[model samples]
Every structure is written in structure tokens, then in C-alpha cells.
Target: MHKKILLAYDGTEEGRVALLECADIAHLLRAETHLLAVMRVPSGVFLAEGFVPDTVMEDERQRIRETIDDGVALLREGGYSAYGHLACGEPVEEICRLAAELGVDLIVLGHRKQTSFASRWWKGSVGISLLERAPCSILVAVGT
Candidate 1:
């Protein structure tokens, strides 16, 4: 029984599908829902420049905040009470950290299929990585 669920929402179409699935599961189990949005600074940005500008970082944070807020609002509109959380860093790391902190029973995420093998290989997979490090069970909702 999932008493608590953490959903990693990125404000994308794929994310929306995961959100819907998570809502249904949460409704079924009567679980507390949490939405997390991570703000990640590109490694290339740090490599190109010695430091990231405060304005740039702030802008990214604002975007993430809005994204999380929107997710929470959507859940609320759907009659689900949910908590929103925001963090800055790697997505997988942030999700794991929040799940541990919240003591969530399950973590939900959206998966976007990559058609090109090279693109998939170069970018790696968050879902695969989460499987190795997540503290609890994970559900990856794939969009059609």
C-alpha cells in the first residue's frame, strides 16, 4: 500500500501523463501526494564560464517554482490535495533526496521515448538510473 507518493514533474507532455496516472493511483490508495520539480544547471554552462550568473540561476529557479506550482494546482483542481517541492541540482539526486526526506512509498516519473539510439546513449536514462538508487518503488509513465 502506498501511503505516500512523490511525483517528479518536468512540465512536459510526458509529465502530464505521469501526473494523471499518479493521481489515479493516489486516489485508489488514499495516499498523500507530493510534486517535485528540479532545477538543473547545465554542466556545459559551468565549463564554458567560471561561474553562473545570479540572474540566470534565479531565472531557472523561478521557472522550476512555477512548474511545480502548476503541477500542484492541477492536482488540486482534480480534487487531489498535493504538496509541492522545489530543489536545485540533478533530477535523480533531487528526487531520491526528497523521497527519503518525505519517506514516500513510491516515486512516479514520466518517460519520453528517444527514437535515436545515439541521442539516447548520449543523454543516458533517468528512469534506469533511478532504479539503481531510488529508496522505494518507482513508476515511469510513458506517453503514447
Candidate 2:
């Protein structure tokens, strides 16, 4: 029953698995797909480093854009009707916000297996956070 699927892609191995899964599901349901790559703002960079250069930020933005473009291309090559978006902000916030704005039926994201409690505590879990805040159903593709 899913008509629109949003894939949160970051070009990681897990992300690639998520992308493939998203594409397969979209194809089976004949749904439209949108790939979103969030460019997280370096909020703490200035505070930690004393100063942040504009060019460095710009380079990061460019890389995120390229990643989004590559995701869209791969989806297209797989014969899925898909598009890409680049957003700036927190990853969880941006993903949920875009999913709401697009009125998507499902959000697909990859999950990295965090083995240690310390790692989870330190990095937090974006997938878990999205599950809490997302307006639609979420499918987390856990990497083996």
C-alpha cells in the first residue's frame, strides 16, 4: 500500500543495503522513491576548533550533494522512478521533516550494529530516534 518511499542514504555500506532494499520494495509496489542525504551542520566545530572556515563547510555540503546525486542515479539505473534531495540540519530531524513534507508512506534507513553500550551512548542511534519522531512507518535495514 506504500505509494511513496523515502530512503535515508549516507553512502555507507549499510546505506547501500538500505538503498537496495528500498528500491526493491518500491519496485514491487510501483511506488515513487526519494533519496535524502542530510548534510549535518558542524555545530560544535567552531566551539571546539575556535574557528571554522567557510570553504571547509562548503566542501562538506558539496560532498553531501554528490552522495545524494549518486543515490538517485543508482535508483534510476535499477528502473525505479526516483529523485534525490540534500538537506542541512540534524540527520534525524531532517529525515523526519522531509518525510512529513513529502507525505511519504514509508521511510527506509540502514542500521549499523553498535556492539558496545558505550558506543551507543556516545554516538546515539539515529534510527531509534527516527522511529520515535517519524510521521510514517520506518523500515530499518540492519546490516549483517
Candidate 3:
């Protein structure tokens, strides 16, 4: 029943695992797959006292673009119909917006386990936020 699946890939180890799982599910369902890499703008860029060079921002964007391209290639090599997308914004917001825009049936994410309670509390959880705000179903693949 899942005709359109969106995979959020960040080129991390966890993300690669999620990509494999998403590819398998997509193939099983004969669904079209889309790989998304969200490029988070550095907080320094927004702070009045902080100075971020244009070159640094460009380099980061290029890296994210390469990651998305690599993820799409991996999916295609695995025999799934797939394409790559790049979004610039907060990860949760970009993911939700893209899912809604594409009218996707499901969104898959790779979740890295927090090692400490403090870290979890400080950074919050993207998976949790997605569960609450995503426009479609979400499948989170936690790294072992």
C-alpha cells in the first residue's frame, strides 16, 4: 500500500542502515523511493555576534548534496526506483514539509541512540518530533 516512501539520509552509519531497511521495504511494496538530506544551517549564521563565512556555508551545502546523491545511488544500485532531494532548514521541519509536499505514503529515518540522558534532554529527539509532526507514517531504524 505504500506507493511513495521518503528516506531521510544523512550519510551517517545509522542513516546507511535505515537506507538499507527502507530500500527493502520499498522493493517489497514496489514503491517509489525518495532520499532526502537536510542541510541544517549553522546557528552561527543566525547569531548577531557570530560570523560564518560564505565559503563555509557553501562547503557544508556541497557536502550535504553529495550525501544525498550517494544515498540515491545506493538505492538505485539496490534495484529500487529512487531520487535524491536536498533541503535547507531544520531537519524535522524540512522532512515534514517535504513529506507533505510529495504526498508520501511513509517517511523512514535512521535514529542514533543517545548515550546519556543529558544529551537526549539537551538535543531533544528528531524521531520523537517526527512522530508528532510528520504528515505521513514514519519508520525509525535505530542503530544497533
Candidate 4:
């Protein structure tokens, strides 16, 4: 029943798994697919410097752009055309904002299993946060 789907892709192995799964699901549902790549801005960017260097920002953007392009290509290879979006900021915030804007029926994400509680605590869990804040149903493709 999903008419539109948003996939949060980060070019990780987990992301590739999600992309493949999403491609199948999208094809089955005849859904519009959107691939989102988020560039995480470091907290230090808001500190004394008040901003990241233009060159550094550009580099980050370019990297994210490439990641999005790669995702699009993968989807195309799978026989599904997808629109790619690049967002700069926190993952959950950007994902929620775009899901709301796109009115997507489902949001797909890739997650790597963390064996240690400390690791999860230090890094925080975007998937957990998204479960609370996301505007649509979420499907997480877990990877080893």
C-alpha cells in the first residue's frame, strides 16, 4: 500500500543491503523511491570558529553527492529509478523533515549491529531516535 518510500542510505554495507531490499519492495509495490544521503556536520563546526571552512564543507558535500549518485546507480541497476536527495545535518532530523516533505508512506534505513552497549551509547542510535520521531512507518535492514 505504500505509494512512496524514502531510503536513508550512507554507502555502508548495511546501506547496500537496505538499497537492495528497498528496490525489491519498491518494485513490488510500484512505489516511488527516494534515496537520501545525509552529511553529518560535526558539532565543532558551531564552536569558536562558528563555521566550517568553505573548502571542507565543499568536500563533505561532494562526498555526500557521490554517495547519493552511487545509490542512484545501484537502484537503477536493480531496475528501479530513484530520486536522490542530499541533506546536511543530523540524520534523524533530516530524515524526518524529508519524510514529512515527501509525504512518504514508509522510511527505510540500514543499521549495523553494535555488540557493545558502550559503543551504542557513545554513538547514539539514529534508528532508535527515528522510531520516536519519524512521521511514517520504518523498516531497518540490519547487517552483520
Clashes of each: 0, 0, 0, 0
True-structure lDDT of candidate 4:
0.91
Evaluation by lDDT, superior candidate among 2 and 3: 2
lDDT of 1 by residue, 70-137 (tens): 99998888888799999888889999999999999999999999989998899888999999999999
lDDT of 4 at 74: 77
lDDT of each: 0.92, 0.92, 0.91, 0.91
Q: Where does candidate 1 stray beyond 4 Å?
A: 47-49
Each candidate: RMSD to true structure?
Answer: 1.4, 1.8, 1.6, 1.5
Give TM-scores for every candidate, taking all chains together and pairing residue i with residue i: 0.94, 0.93, 0.93, 0.93
Candidate 2: misplaced stretches above 4 Å? Answer: 47-51
Tens-digit lDDT track for model 4 on 1-144? 899999999888999999888998999998889999998877776657587788888998998899999899878787786899999889999999999999999999999888899999999999999999999999999765
Worst 10 residues of 2 by lDDT: 43-52
- Residue 74 lDDT in candidate 2: 91
Model 3 residue pairs with clashes? none
Best by TM-score: 1
Q: What is the Å distance of residue 69 in model 3 from its true position?
A: 0.7
Give the better candidate number (1 or 4) by lDDT.
Answer: 1
Worst 10 residues of 3 by lDDT: 44-53
For candidate 3, the per-residue lDDT at 38 reads 87
As a whole number from 0 to 100, the lDDT of residue 59 in candidate 4 is 90
